[model samples]
Target chain A: MTSLPALPTPKKLGLVIDLDVCVGCHACVVNCKEWNTGGYGAALSDQDPYGADVSGAWLNRIHTFEVVPQGGEIVGEAGEARIVHFPKSCLHCEDAPCVTVCPTGASYKRADDGIVLVDEDMCIGCGLCAWACPYGAREMDLAAGVMKKCTLCIDRIYNETIAEIDRQPACVRTCPANARHFGDLADPSSAVSIMVAERGGMDLMPEQGTRPVNKYLPPRARKPLASSTPLPKEDTTGATGFFAWLDDMLDRI
Target chain B: MHPAPSIIIFTTLSGLGYGLAVVLGLGLLDPATLATKIAHVLAIAMIGAGLMSSTLHLGNPQRAWRALSQWRSSWLSREGVMSIVTFVPLLWSAWVCVIESRYLALPGLAGSVLSLATVFCTAMIYTSLKSVQAWHTPLTPACYLLFAAAGGLVVASLFAFAGGGNASLLAVLAAVALMAAWIAKTAWRRNMLTLVPISTPETATGLGAIGKVRLFERPHVMENYLTHEMGFKIARKHAAKLWGIAVVLGGAVPVVALLVLAIVGQVSSAIAAMFACVALLSHIIGMLTERWLFFAEARHAVMNYYNG
Candidate 1:
């Protein structure tokens, strides 16, 4: 039952995140939890919400990293260090090991749209799917005794009642900086696909060979800052004393 | 990977059980004997206890029967199916041996093959995981098979000594199996230590082009399922100490004990039986520790995202 689709899907609907504009505001993270908690996978339980060690199951998470360009100066008037805001969720991989490792057929990928999902009803909470995931995309809901993961907001994206413009993942709609884009990656002409092509989007851990559908656009290169005023040239003309030379230079300036 | 006690106990006890079943199925011990009957009963008990303990770790133990449906694709499911299927022949063989007081050749052979196959399936459950480099190796199954054989032989030796039949041969077999298990385990540990992680922070983020990357801040201030499940870390010194203990108790002590049985078994059958029991007990404890380390030491590929 956990076997993969015999044929690949035609439409690989996924996400393309732009790291350049992400401000690490965590709007995506917060909104994902909010929507998912009340939405399809309801009540993403938090253990000890007010206690010392707070832990819970969250589908989307953001990680901030400090990436310094190689052989670049440590400190400069122009920005030399880049702080990247990485928002991570399920990529709905074409070769998702998570889906294949499920013992009860709870985890699976849709052949029509290529959206990976978990069927809570069938899940026995063995947690093998989570272990098989290289992206850390799956989370086990201990209270519910089932695994939770990003479903790409299947309820909203395909819902006829929702407005067309709003028919996207909650995280994408909630991103304050408009850093997340959702569309069909299989179509070359799709907006998200075009953006990926233009921005040189890349897969995380290509060696793992999960073939993640989500792509991350690297941060843009920084432009050097131009100084407003040029320094005055030093006048080292014949001056007998230091004080006299300073006075003459000051007068000339 | 947290070393959950349920799984550790399941694998260890079940491995021992299946190993004993395989030995019994091979007609290594006399079928029309009280010692063989005791061994058969012990095997069934160990397997039943192990299978039951495995469900303790499941979130819905009542729904565990559903796990057998995916045997065509999942190793875990195959293990479940195989274990259940193996029990039929195993129980039949035991019944014939204990009740009829004779070995049923066909049923005994079938049970033996199925028992070993079930153990292979158990090993495949971990070996098939691509995300865990430490366990995704040929050595994993080899080690499992060897340890099971070694543990089974030691138990069989004890029964044989108690029954006053071929104690020296069983003891020698146990000794050889123990030595092989130890060598294979040592190799597995060495391989795991030397294996360069295919996944790293740079690869995980796909920003290796940006030079060295370090996490400045995490997504949340609190821990989450990913962190809790995959973030298990064991100190190097503690792991080394456990490794030493496991080798000494599980491998060396059993080997020495079995060797003593082989030498003094004819002269002092009572003393040899006692030594055999000691080896069995020590090996069980040692395997438990080894299984704990097995889980503790494995670094899941998902952990690279958390800088684990």
Candidate 2:
């Protein structure tokens, strides 16, 4: 049951995140938790809520990083010190190692939309799926004794009752910076696919060879600022004469 | 990886059990003898205990039966199915040797092949993980197989001594197997030390063009499931000490003990049996420590996000 599908789905639905404008805001993280808790996977429980070391299962997390220049510091003018706000979630990879490592057949990818999901009823919570995933996407739900993950908001995406535009993932819908975009990456004409083409969106850890469906658009280079003119030099040798002249000029004024 | 005691015990004890079962199935030891009967019973006990211990680590043990249905792809599932399948021939072999007082070549051979296959399946559970570079190697299974064979030989030697058979041959076999296991393990550890991580913080975030990346802040103030399960870190100093312990107890002690038994076994069978028992006990302890280190040292790919 853990075996991958023989033929991949024609439509590969995924996300394209732009790193150029992400403000490290936790709105997506908060919204994902809010929606998933009551959505398909309910009660994403928190343990010791008010304790000194509070912890819980979260499907999405945002990490901030300072990307320092590799080669030494820039000499004269300061080199750009880039800080990226990366939102980490399941890429829903085409060859997801997580799906194949599941012993209970709980983890699976949908053939229709290429969405990865877990059947909570069959999950034994062995945590092997989490171990198989290089992205750290899967989180074990201790309270329910099952695995919980992004699900890409499967319930919302497929629901007919919700407005068509709002039927995307909660994270993408609630992102204030508009950094997250969802569409069919397989379709070259799709906005997400076009953005990937234009911005040269990249895969995370391509060496892992998971063939991730999601892509990330790297931050654009910063524009150089125009230089300002130099200030006039002071006449230190004729300080007394200059003061006297300045006083006379002021009196005349 | 947290190196849960349940898993450690499961792998070590079950490996030893299966190894013993394989040796018994090979007809290397006389199945008609009382010594072989005692060994068979012990092997079954070890396997039973190990299988029982494996469930302790599961979040929901009641649903473990569901794990067997996914043998098509999952090594864990395959291991479960194989373990159950192996038990049939293994139990039949044991019954034939102990109750029927006979050694049926066919059943014994089937059990032997299945037992080793089960061990391979167990090792594959770790070997198949692409995220853990330390465990994803051909040497992983090789080491597991060698260690199990070595442990089985030691048990067989003890049984041979107890049943008034020639224990020297089994001791020599145990010694050779132990040496091979240790060598493979050393190679595996060497490979792990030099492994250039495939995923980095840069690659993980797809921001390598920016520059050298470092985590500015964590997403949450408190730990999460990922951090708890995958963020396990061991200090270099502690790991070095544990490695020494694993080598000495699991590898060196058994090798030397078996050699001593082989040489002195011809002199006094009583003394040889005592040393064989010593080797068995020490090897179990060593194997447990080794298994613990296996989980403790492995770096999961997800750790790249946590700056691990």
What would the DockQ be for model 2? 0.76
Model 1 Cα lDDT, one tens digit per residue, B31-124:
8889999899899899999999999878767778889988888899999999999999899999998899888888889988998899999999
Error of 1 at B277 (Å): 0.9
Q: List candidate 2 stretches off by more than 4 Å.
A: A72-79, A224-253, B266-268
Prediction 1 global C-alpha lDDT: 0.88
C-alpha lDDT of residue A215 in model 2: 94
Candidate 2 RMSD to the correct structure: 3.6
Tens-place lDDT per residue, model 1, A1-253, is 5787779789999999999989989899998898899888546899998899989989999898777677643434345666788999999998998888788888889989999998888889889898888889988888888889999999889989989987999999998899999999999999999999999999998888889999999887665433345576786655579878787889899
Over all chains combined, what TM-score does candidate 2 have?
A: 0.93
Q: Write the per-residue lDDT of candidate 2 for residues B1-308, one digit (tens) a residue.
A: 88888999999999999999988888777877888898889889999999999998787889999999999899999999999999998899899989987888887899889989999999999999989988999999999999989888888888887763568888888889999999999999999999999888888887777678888788888778888888888998999999999899998998898887777656666667777788889888889989988999999988888888
How far off is residue B95 in model 2, in Å? 0.7
Among incorrect, acceptable, medium and high, the docking class of model 1 is: medium
Q: Taking the tens digit of each residue's C-alpha lDDT, what string does model 2 give over A92-179?
A: 9999999999999999988877888899989988889999999999998889989998898888888999999989999999999999
Candidate 1 lDDT for residue A223: 55
TM-score of each: 0.93, 0.93
